[model samples]
Target: MPVYEFRCQACQRKSSFFVRSIGGSLSPACTACGSREMSRVISGFAYHKSMATIHEESGGPDRPGSDYYKDPRNIGRWTEKKFKDLGMEMPSQIQEMIQSAREGEMPESVKDLQPNLTDV
Candidate 1:
């Protein structure tokens, strides 16, 4: 389940709701004025820590898009152009594993561990 923030236009009230995905946004009628003219706010939920926060908590590898990647010592010997020249197709699972690692969640399997070898 995911929590979403919605704002009521009629009463100018904001509320958060834990909703099941019903294939669309959960913009309900205003609880105060009963107006269907509510507009969903794009932000304001703090239910979970962000990826950076999670990385800080785990004390894991450096963040992917940080200044660390800009260092010459951190640069990969084979660049993206080299991989493209090799005609390599990045596996979807490897992509997902890299994403997970970036979020500080390392999967405990041989295949999942491969991405950890690369500089996140």
Candidate 2:
């Protein structure tokens, strides 16, 4: 089996499709918008790392968009983008987090959590 990446023009979301055969009769639809019009996209590979390196190639903390995530608004956008990229439904917990950030408030549970001694 092989996985293929596709971008939907309508929703501007990307998703992966696992296929048993390439030549067989099969069509892919956008998981988010249910649009059949999609284009193949080149997928990037990811790897696990023990530590992040400050380099352009590795996309570390020093990367251009890294600072964008620090903003609460951008954090919500990033979360939506991530969910769209993975073709996964945004979970309720994540939705609440984004909503709270957009509203300039932290979730009550996160705000009320007391730091453990071990964390310090």
**For all candidates, what are the clash counts?**
0, 0
Which parts of model 2 have CA positions greater than 4 angstroms off? 46-120
Q: TM-score for all predictions?
A: 0.35, 0.36
Best by TM-score: 2
Q: Number of the top candidate by lDDT?
A: 2
Candidate 2 lDDT, 1-120, residue by residue in tens: 556788998998998887688788658899999999999886752112222332443342223344544455544554466578889998988778767766787665533332232432
For all predictions, the C-alpha RMSD in Å is: 13.0, 16.5
lDDT against true structure, model 2: 0.62
TM-score of 1: 0.35
Please provide, for model 1 over 40-119, each residue's C-alpha lDDT reduced to its tens digit, 9 standing for 90 to 100. 67673443535546556444233343444333333332233345667987566655555555555546642333334454
**CA shift at 24, candidate 1, in angstroms?**
4.1
Error of 2 at 43 (Å): 1.0
Candidate 1's displacement at residue 52, Å, is 11
